[model samples]
Target: MCPPGTMRNSTGATGIHQCEPCTGGHYCEGYGNTEPTGLCDPGYYCPANRSVSSPQPGDLKCPKGHYCLEGTVEPYPCDTGTYQPNEGRTDCIPCQAGFYCESALEPDPQPCPPYHYCPEATMYPIPCPNGTFTYDNETGLASEGECQPCISGAYCRGGYIMDACAGGYFCLSGSYEYTPAGDPPPANPDQDPCTPNTQCAGPCPAGHYCPVGIEDPIACPNHTIRNTTGASQLSDCRPCPAGSHCLQGDPVEYECPVGYYCEEGMPPEECPLYTYRNTPGAASEGDCYPCRAGYWCNDTGMVTFNQNPCPVGHYCERATPYPEPCTGGRMSTETGRRSNEDCPLCTPGYYCPNDTINVHGIPCRPTYECPEGASLEVVCRPGAYCEGVTGVPPDCPGGYYCPLGSSSYTRCFFPKYCPVEVKCLWNVRLDTWRCHILD
Candidate 1:
C-alpha cells in the first residue's frame, strides 16, 4: 500500500498501479483509488459528483467573511458580535473600535453613530455625557466623538440637541450634573451653605426670606418693616418701631393715631376709658391721661367724649374721673365739686356737729346761754345769776354782788357802828378831841 495521502488507480485489474500524490485540496488516505480519502482539509471545500473514476476538481475557495468545512458545498457567515477580514477564514474575530457587529450574518462591523461611542467588540452605541454634544459623522477609531460644551443655561444630555434647564434648576457647561438653584453668596461674609455643583445663586425673593442654600422661601415674620423683600440675612429684617402700628409682613411703618398706643413689634391698642391721648404717635399706655376732676367719665377700654358733671350731693376728688356720695355731715349745694373738701362743715349755734344726720332747730344746754350759730354752750347772763331756774333767768338778791354773765354772786359781810362824844371837851386842844365807838 502507498503511504497515506497517495492515490492508486485500477481498471478491473487484480493488482494496483503505481501511486500518485493527491491534489492540493483533496486527500486520499485509503488503499484502492476511489477518491481522496476525505473531501478536503477542514476550512476548504470541493465540488460534488467528483469521484476516483474521474479526478475531482480542485477545491474551491470560500467567500470573504465566510467559512466552509470539509465536504461543504456552501459557506456560513460569522457569529454575532464577530467578523472576518479575508476570504475563507476559519473563524471570526471580535468587532473593532468605532464599529458594531450585531449579528453573525453581518459581513463586516458597522460604524458607530454620530455623537455616540462603540467600544471594541461592542454591538451597540453609547451616547455622550450630559451638558456636552458631539458632531455627527465623527468617524475616528476612538469609538466616540470629542464632545463639545453646551451653551450657558443649557445642557446636552445623551443627544445632539441642546435643552434649557428647568425652573429652579441649572446645569453648567462641560458637566454632567443637574442642580437646583441656590441662594446668593452670603451677605455678611459668612460661610456659604450651598452644596457643590450648583449652577446659579441669587438673593431671597420679595415677600419671602431664604437664609441659606437652595432651601424653600419663607414668608416674612409679623411686624416686618422696610423693604424686606429679597432679604438675604437676619439683619435685613427691621422690626416695627414703637409709636407705630404694623401688620404681619408690612412693608412700611404706620403711625399710630391719637387715642391709640403702639408698642414695638405689636399692633396699636386703643386708649382705656376715662383716658385721652390728644396727640398722634402715642407709644404706650402711660401716654393716655386720666379724665379731669368734677367730670364723670363712664366708658371703658375706649376713648370717650361723654363728660358729665358730678351730680348734686356728690363730689369728685382731684384727678378723679368718677363722682362719690358725700358722708360725715358734709354737704354741698353746689353742682360741681372738684374735691370732697369742697363740702362745707355743719353750721354753728344749731348744734349740727354730728356726722350722721343734718341737725336742725336743736338748742344749747339749759341754763347755759349760746351765741347765734354757736356749736357749744356758755354761762347765763348777769341779772340772771340766780340758782335753779328753768324757763327764765332770775335777778340777784339785794345783799349779794353779781358780775355780767356770771352763774353765781357773793353776799356782803359787814356790821353797823355809831359814834359817841367824849367828856373831855374842856381843857384842851381842839386837835385832841377824839371819837369813841358805842357797842
Candidate 2:
C-alpha cells in the first residue's frame, strides 16, 4: 500500500490491476484512491511518484536561497540583505562582518562606502560620527574601524578630504574643525598638553599673538614677556622703567650700573665728568655726586670722587673740579689741601722760586740771603759774610774790611810795600785802615 495521498488501481474480486503512482505536482497519501491528494504545501516540492511507493522521495521544502509555493517544482530567490549557502534551508541568513547582502540571494557580502559603515545586515551605509572621518586609504574597514579620530592641525567633516588649520588657529586632537583665536586653554592640567584638549579660538592667549588660521600662537616681542598663556591685544606689552634697561626678549629689566643713569625705554647713560653715582640704578641727575676738594676730576662718564690728588704747586678748594695754582711768592708742598690759604710763605733768607711748585722755599746762593720782607736774595752787608739766615753774617777776616753791601772784603796791604809786623783794621765805609808799628 502507498502512504498518505498515494494509491494503486485495483478491482474488488479480481487480482490487483497494474499498480500506479501519483502524477506530477501531486501526492497520494493512504493509498486506495485513484485521484491525487491536495496540491503540495508552500515551501515544499512534489514530484511524480514511483509505482505504489508509501512515501514520495521528491517531496521536500525549498532551500535557504529560494522560496517555494504550493505545488511548485522550483524555488524563487530570497530578498536582498540575506544569503542562502546551503540547499533545503528554511530561511536565509544575514551577511556578517557588518556588511550588507545588497542583492537577493547574494553569494558574497558588500562593503560600505568611504566615511560610511553598514552595521550587521543593514540595508544602507551610515555616515561617520562627528569628529571622525574615513579615507580611501582605509578601505575594507569594519563598522567599528570605519571612523578615525581627527588629529591636531587638521579638521575632519566625516569625508575623505581633511583640512589644515588656518594661520593663527589650532585644531586640537579629536576636533571636528579648526579653532578660532583668543580661545582659552584647558585648565587644571598638571603638565603641558601632550594631546589636544580644547578647541582653538580667535586671537591667541596672553604673551602670544595669532593671525588668521594660525597653527600656533606667536611669542611676544622682546622685553614684552608675560606669564600668562594668551595675549589678545598689543597693550599687554610693557617697557623698561626708570633705573632699569631692557634687551630683546628679556624677562625682567636690568638695573642701571653704578655711575650710570637709566630712563624708561632708553639705554643707560654714564655720569658726566666730575660727576658720579655711588650705587647702581641711578635714575636722575641728582644722583650724581660732585667732585670734591683736593681732587682733579678729569674723567668723563663716572668720576671717582676725590680720587686724583691735587697736582704739585696747585691748590684746590672744597668741591673744586680742578686744582688751582699757588699765587704770589707762596708755595704748595702737600697734597689734598683745601684752599690757597693752605699754602705757606717761603722760608727766611731763602726765596720761593717764581711759579715753582711742591716746595717750601728756594735757597739763596753763597754770600746772598733772602730778607724777611723781600721777594729776592741780596748780597750780605759789608764786613760780614752772608749765610742762609737774613740779617746774620760773619765779620770780615783780619787786616781786611768789606764795603757796605759788598760781596767780598778788601786787603789791608797795598801791593807788596806794606810794613812788616804792622796790623791793619779796615774801615769798610771809608775804604781806609790805620797801621801801628811794634811798640
Candidate 3:
C-alpha cells in the first residue's frame, strides 16, 4: 500500500503521485492507470505500483551495490542484478566478475572462486591449474596462463613447464636433438657415439677392438694376436719356416740353415743360394728356392745342400771351394773333369783328368793304360770297360785286370756287362779287343 501522495489508494488517481507524471522523465505502470509519476527513475528498477510500498522518499534501492533490503518492495528496491542510486541499501551485492546472475531461474549464479577466472565465452574460466600458465592477470579478465606453449621433445600439459628431454634427444642450436625444456643426459665421456673405426686413446690390441659408445673393449678375429697393453694396432699370427721351430715360448724371430732359408714350418732348404736371404724374414728376404744346378753358394762354408750344382759342361774343380755361378761350356772325357770332389774320375768311358767333373764323349785311353806298365803287350781284364779301338794294342778302360804281359780283360763283381766281341784283353788278343757299339 502506498502512503498518501504516493499512490494512497488502489485507484492510483492523480492524487496518489508525489510529482507530475511526465515531468523528470516519468511514465506510469499500474492497474490504477492514474498514477502520476509514470515509471521509476532511469537507473532504478522498481516493481508495479499503488498499494505497493515505495523506497525512502526521493530514493530507489537495489542489489549490485549492497543495497536493497530483503523482501523490500519491488517499487522500493530495484530488481536482483541491477542497482539503484539511493543509499541505505540492505541486500548484499548480487554478483559480479567471475560470477553470473540469473532471473528466478531454477539454478542460481555460481559465484567465482580465487585462482579461477571467467573466460570470454565461459561463465567462469576453470582454474589454470598447477602445471599450466597464461598471460592475462587482473583476476581472470581474459585469456591467462593456459596459452603458454612448450618446445619440442618437451611435455607441456596444461601451462606449466613440461618434463625435460635428455641429451642426444633435445635439439641443440636448431639440431634434431634439441628440445626446449628438455632433460639432460647422464654425463659419461667414453667415445664419440657417431662414427666407426675411430678411437680416442688409439685402438685396443689385436683380436680385440672397441666399438664407439661402448664402455669396454671388443674381441677380434680368430688366429690373430693382440698387443694387450694399450697398443696402437694389432699384429697377425705367423708360422715358422724351414729349419726353424716355433712354439709357445719361441721369440717372434725365426732362422734357417746356413746358406738356406726355412719355409712352410719345415727345416731349412736351399735358396737361390748365391742370392739367398741373408737375413731371416728380412722385409725383402722372400728369395728361398735353391739355385739351379748351374749356380753355387757364393757364401762359403757348407750349407752345402742349399748350394747349386755345377752347370753342364763346367766343373767345380776343388773341395772346400767357394762356389761361383757356373758359366756355360762343353767338356771332354779323355781327362778327368773338375768336380767338387777334386776332379773325381769320370764314367769309365768318359775320363776327365783335370780338376773338374764335366766329361763329354771324348775317347778314353782304351788302347794303352795298364795297371802295371801299360805297354803294347798288356790288355784289359774281363768284364772291364774295354774302350779300345778295333785292332788296337793294349789301352783299356779303368777297372780292367790285364794279366802280366797280356792284353785280355777280366770280369769283376758288380760291374756293367761287357759287350759281345768286347772281350777283356788280359792275356792275349790285344789287337782284337774292342768295346761293342749299340749299333
Q: Give the alpha-carbon lDDT of every model.
A: 0.53, 0.59, 0.36
Comparing 1 and 3 by TM-score, which wins? Answer: 1
TM-score of each: 0.32, 0.46, 0.22
> For each predicted model, how many residue pairs clash, with residues at least 3 apart or on different chains?
7, 33, 76
Number of the top-ranking candidate, with TM-score as the measure = 2
Expressed as tens digits, the lDDT of each residue in 87-174 for candidate 2 is: 5554567766557667655667777777777776655566766556777755445575457765545666664436765544444444
User: Root-mean-square deviation of each candidate, in angstroms?
Assistant: 18.8, 12.0, 19.5
Q: Sorted on lDDT, highest at the top, how do the candidates line up?
A: 2, 1, 3
18-91 in candidate 1: lDDT tens per residue? 55665444566555544466566456554433222222333455656667666554566766567766665567
Model 2 misplaced regions, further than 4 Å: 1-236, 344-356, 359-361, 367-439
Ordered by TM-score, highest first, the candidates read: 2, 1, 3
**How well does candidate 3 match the true structure, expressed as C-alpha RMSD?**
19.5
Off by over 4 Å in 3: 1-36, 49-59, 65-123, 126-141, 144-146, 151-153, 161-439
Better of 1 and 3 by lDDT: 1
For model 1 the local lDDT of residue 170 reads 26
